[model samples]
Target: MLDLFGDEDTLALAESHRTLPGRFGAGTRDRAGVLSALSALSQQAGGAEFGIVLGSGFEGAPDLIAEIGARHRLLGAAPETVAALNDPFRLAALCARLAIPHPAITAGPVADRDAWLVKRIGGCGGSHIRASATGSTPPGHYLQARMPGRAFALNFLSDGRRIEPLALTEQWQAPSPLRPFRYAGALARGRDEAEPIPPAIEARIAEAALRLARETGLTGLASADCLVEGERWWLLEINPRPGATLDVLDRRPTPLLLQHIEASLGRMPAIEASPTDATGAEICYAARTCPAMPPLDWPDHVHDRPRVGSPVARDAPLCTVTASGPEAVTVKEELRSRTAQVRTLLEETENSHEFQHERPEPQRPGGTAGREPRR
Candidate 1:
């Protein structure tokens, strides 16, 4: 249960934790810091053995994966698999070979930049996706033509030989002035999901994912992002690791983590039908900067709590709000309401002069705020 942390709650679910030198973000700024952190964490492990199961943050950083794998066993996809899956050109070629519909992608200039999106080669989350018209494509980025359809993700477990579909989630974006395609949250498809995906369509998406996994030797928990309009669909990308929907889809009697471990060992677990309760999870971003976070009673539904006196930057994730109900619409509505309530709580905390005076001393810099608790 040894894991890494960066200004996030070290007291998070993991039994043991180590700290990274810098804050969390994309690119080279954090690379040396992560390797240094892993070095320290590995020594702390002593002679103990463990395996790595990656999450969203490491999708684009295969070098880090290889570095970690060199020291410890890997419980997920290999670094080469991750590198290939994260390449847009490689993905498009695979889709073409498999006859899966994929939007046209190119590194060269496009006639109508507005009609295309510039995406980083290994970007995770949607923050790296922007309209081509916004600016010239940066190094390590490519352009993909915009396609019509709603966003959906298919979650599955693979054993390098076969795959077992886990769950499908409908996704939405929380666009900001600069990040037009920022990922907001996801809602698991259930009996009450609005205009539920047809069985045939689900099967088609599942088959495509299976084919992609088999071809790439993908192992462990992974998710496939796609777009669907009516029966027509397009495979967007494969996040070769466990993704955000885990909050909504990980309630089965058998923990998906164990299943991931087993699958990585070439033993695929038999997955039962997904829970029928429509569960949703959304991020509550801070609207304004808070010089210091006030200690308050965080409701059970509100998770990823920051430490007292921690600085909360505007537009940074404050916490995650989750809700579940018999119907998807009502569950989503509840999520919105809860998100508002959490924001109001933060406002009230900021304005409380008495509480301000009584605010507890800040603890260590690391506390789980925006990043996932490493495992």
Candidate 2:
């Protein structure tokens, strides 16, 4: 078993092996490296149950699956349908095929430098994505006219035929006139803060997603990233796997991860809305500068947290702090206050001597017993 991103517990569930390089970044060379790694891992883990690949992690693994070629040819309908549903040269091609209204797009790369976006033809998580300045375009990529307006991501789950929307989150990117827009975090907008999705646009997105599933024979969880300008909804990209909001899905009574696993095993459960409807604004607060990893000396109260020596990076996920109340503003304020406390605690831990010399425990299966954070 080759579990690329597996933690100790996850590894215990399968036969673990080494990881392939370039699982995170985007570039022709890196993408190629990832593909090669996947292929090697697949060959190594022959006859294992279905392989679940994340992001560029899928590169070559599919080839290793015994019947994957036939399965993809027979079951992978959405990818092919999306490819043929629209002409790469025209924006209207997608709109016509999906029966949705969108900002007009040219079929090919825009000749004018300021009017086009050169984007990857695959999934979207802010990877391998870029906007073109007319003449500066990458080869072998899809080009479409850029749509103007704020961006919104609607996260949902599907059971082949039935689709259940979880939440519509507003994405925030740092205001950088010089740098390409990068996804920072998501905000759970309340009634006042929530941006309303018109029925027409919602219907269009849902229909397109369903049609995609039907075409591709997708049977489990997936997400669609779309842009909303005025009343128009423009399809951005579709992810065949879980999205960044997987943690949000974890808050559900039956975690989306479990659901996906079950679906993959051919046990499709009845899809339902998340058990918890508590909603306010949820935003990912991050450091504008590098924040050092804090030591683990939590009080005896908090439990089941990461160890003191866990390696955390700038963009690597730390922990998600959520707040909810009867109203949106109150929840937003609560989350903000809570996040500040977390940051302060982390900073204090960094400055403390305990963090500098604490030795992490040996790797153990479900070894989180005493190491959990005491909040």
Candidate 3:
């Protein structure tokens, strides 16, 4: 995955690992650095089938991919589609034209700031969202009226002509003083479970996905976020890229990326039988500044780990914890237990006298802390 977080350990998980600092896109100031990274990725991917772009840093994916001068195919939507969907105002307009129900959205700086939210165009994680009253009408920002409901997302594949369901995930966020509106994790719905959304509402989502794909030239793997209220639902945004929830939903015998490639080539594969168990993943963030993050003999559930003695600021993620069970309750409990244990360990590490005596090195710039490690 061409994203911010590094899965250096998971190079074996896939053929390519063209990751760069994408946390905030600040550390990557030099155009030369990005060019160098892509050049290296291409070199590593000799005779490779294609290149896939994921995550928020690629606001200019169309331009960047073109400039990178890739030799292989580029999977996912057209550059024009990506650019159009990245703009919330344009997206809302599209939703209106398609009769897709969306939150009351308008141009920047609404008069009733308290009732709306300020969100960044092309923003991925919830981190870029802010209460309208607290935010200015900055460039690339728009307002959507705050809707009361739990957050949910649907992962689907499109073959330019048809849409296929992949999975439904419940999105979680832990807003705090340090990392307000932080993406905490997502829980995949089980086969024998009740979805947060009703069947009728889900049908609307499927219809919307197909229509959006038809209008926007969206193909390959993508996700659509929504706010579900009882029987009614409002569309939040559509991400026409490989999603972070793929880890939980992708259970086909064939690798999901291959299917993504097939979809891009205008083919929709039949959904194969897979795991019926509920799977959930969470991002465990540091509650306080930890000067020393010693590597622990983490259990098998842990992934996307930080290096030992890594100085993590308060609210930055330490690692990801995943659990599987027959139901969401058990999976959620397991995640909570593991997350609490890790947080305790982090607190202990911070209090150690070795940590106090040790002079920690400055953190690397342009990293997502611990969020969105897709590889």
Candidate 4:
């Protein structure tokens, strides 16, 4: 298999991995580089047939997908379907038509900046979201009134004709000063086990997802993020591609990626949610800048390892940690413990390296260089 190898985690997953022409970030900035990389890889494929299955970053940019699909097959939603699902106004209208609760959104103006959030179009992760009061909205962004509720996502697989519910994930935030709603991690109960949400709410969300998929002809794995308060809920947005929960949900005997390809081809697999351990995954961020990554043993639960000597900036993602067990509460506790362990390990390693590299004072002309300064 071939992949863009955007991070170290993906670097080892594919037989042949290539980097894009430039750094990849949220929004529409990296489309050209993606096209260039795909062209190069396609040429080297020696006329072999291959299809594209995307993750989080590309769902907001259907034209880019169209450009990529022009040369190769796309094993996901069509460009029109993507445009329909991703457009904020269109989605709001669709929700209204379908009698689904949706937050008020507008691209034109915000009467109360404090009441709304500025979100970049096609932006995944909480980094791209900020209060409208923070700054003016840039191009390819919109304003949505902040909803009051806890965050949740329903992950599902679709085949254009039908859908299968995968898992219900409860998401949380890791707030920084600037990024108060930054995505921290998500937790889900064991497959086939009782989800954290009420059965009524789960049914409602599943129904909404199925209806939205039919309306947009959505195919492959996707996630629908929402906010729920008591029995009331609002659909936030649809990530029309594989989402972050893939780590926790893709544990079946048949790999989900292969199933994704089949679903995209209009064939739905008979995927029964088997009973499995509850899983939790979180993204750990660096607390300080590391000029060079120091060598240290990463725990078994830690993943997305950066190469030694790679510079890690303060507040940047350091790595991901995952945990799984028979119960959700214990799994979450384990995730927290593992996250702390990884952070502490990095801090100690860096400190030890600094001490090892410390330079001692040399003897001065007066032979008092090693002495402490006298008050």
Candidate 5:
């Protein structure tokens, strides 16, 4: 899996960002390379226990995953199921079949582009999504009618028949001229065991997730992207794997891979609510082209340290800042403040440099091992 973290000792590791010097992923474009690299690496590191694919790029191309699965055991959804969910029209159809609330989805552009968004199939982190304008129907894309409300994500553990809700998180996107709709991060507002569950919304979301999981055979750590407006809840998509915000929502001693493996094996480990207050993670992006990665005196709160001298492009995320507190509002404010501080530090470092003569590299590696700094 190409992500932020490497595989545990129990499993052979083959992921992007193999070391601290790795760059971020460029979606499915890196699959071929990751596939080749993992092939040799998997052989060397004592055959993999199972493959866990990551990101929207992986979601976009299910066939590639299927092929990889042939060589390595994969612990997530079947390729066919991924294909069904990857298609927006099919996902909406499934929602209707399962009686789940969903926004009106169109196979083509809607009349009012302002109220619609053109989204690519299987795109993650809202990167391949854009406001609909032209009536043109791009291949592998669909128009989703915008709904009124703030976005919320439900991170849950599923045994393919029953769902154990983990945490309910709020989604944020940091938009820029270069990278509009880039995923910012998430805040864990509610947990199933400890944190307070919002009145009716929690039950509705859990019911939807349970039904979908049973129907699709989704297991392990997966997330449901949803929108809540008034007393109603609408599910946007279901990512059938351990996703971003796994850290923010779950600060418990149990590691994420353990939870995922247990659920995949049909085990429901006892989960307790967060004992602390609301906690969140936010990514600070590069507002302008920078010469080199700044020297950040990272406290325990900061994560995903950039490789020294790695050039960051305009709108690309620099690093993630984290904060936890008793109140939700306080945590949110702290994350915002930290984000600004990091951005300021990067700017100051760039301006003071005699100029390192660095530019953002175009060739991004495919073998990633870190969680995306995504909402």
Candidate 6:
């Protein structure tokens, strides 16, 4: 049952809509319409089993009867390897061949002027990124070497030799002096209630992500992005798909999408540990209007309640409000007073749908008023 980024409301809240058209790049004539919709959902679920690809979301498609370790197949580390570890320059050459402490790269393409970061050696979420300067090239490229600090993301889940550290956020708006990519909020929490990942920089980013998943033998879900500095972290890329907080591991307690379908059937299950102290938060706010129609109207002192019509654009994602308490300023003041009541009901329903279509009320882009101070 091919489900390349399946989205029938996340397979009706996760039932099992499996598919892996390289992970979501339904092009090339939608790859025979996703192999005829995975041969009619595999005769209503009887055959067809393993497959998981994510990196440039399945560019060409076809080639996945069983292959799951993305970043385009982690440069073929084989474990039933499918194909397509496409870009990010092989995750910065597997973190400099596992010396891990990345960020100081040069790969291919870039002429040098002063500041560099072209990105798209097969990008993700923060799509087609750019941040040039060092001899600015900007014309279909790949010139990284712009890593300074303050940008954190580490969502993990591996089985090729134990590795499950999930939740450690702060990937707010990338592409500014090199946040590289990821341009929306994600505050997740609990890493000792966060702000303290320095056990030798989290054991050098978990030993360079288990040495790039034991030299690319990558197993289920993976994510990494670091740059810390001052207790040092560095290593910037490596995302074998299933992250954008993968629904914050679906409020964990064992539900990382059903542990990526029970680790794609091999079943290594058992992953709870994410509360050395327990505290949670997730904030994603963006506006420029166009928040997809809805049966709107929500404001009951917002708390753990948001999923009204979803589908917002202007670079994807526009509403995520999570909040958990027990401390950490009571879950950041209940996710800052319920994301300010969902930003005043998305600015009064986009100013009453631009005054009933007569249009002309847009003029509010000056430093987003107040109340964004819960860092």
TM-score of each: 0.91, 0.66, 0.87, 0.89, 0.85, 0.28
Best by TM-score: 1
Q: TM-score rank, highest first?
A: 1, 4, 3, 5, 2, 6
Best by lDDT: 1
- Candidate 5 lands at a TM-score of 0.85
lDDT of 3 by residue, 109-146 (tens): 56667898877666656767788875356776678889
lDDT of 1 by residue, 80-176 (tens): 9898888788889999999999999988587777789999877767877888985357898888989999999888999988988877888988888
Taking the tens digit of each residue's C-alpha lDDT, what string does model 6 give over 61-90?
A: 324323233312232123332232434555
Across 155-220, the per-residue lDDT of candidate 4 in tens digits comes to 888998788887888999888887777788888887656766688998899899999999999998
Clashing pairs in 3: 23-367, 23-368
Q: Candidate 3's error at 58, in angstroms?
A: 1.7
The lowest-lDDT stretch of 10 consecutive residues in candidate 4 is 366-375
Q: Count backbone overlaps in model 2.
A: 11
- Encode model 5's per-residue lDDT on 1-375: one tens digit a residue: 344333232024333334222433334445566677667656656754355544434677788878877777677676776777667887898999988999888877466778888887777877667888785458877888888777788889888888888778888788876457778888886332343346688788889989888887777888888888778778999987766686586687777677777777778777765545678888877666654565555666777666555455666666778888877778889999988888787676667655464545332222222324443
Better of 2 and 3 by TM-score: 3
Off by over 4 Å in 2: 1-20, 27-95, 102-109, 159-162, 175-179, 187-195, 262-268, 273-276, 279-292, 297-319, 357-375
Ten-residue segment with the worst summed lDDT in candidate 2?
366-375
Candidate 1's TM-score reads: 0.91
Candidate 6 residue runs with Cα over 4 Å from true position: 1-94, 97-115, 118-130, 134-154, 157-162, 165-207, 211-223, 226-247, 254-296, 299-318, 321-375
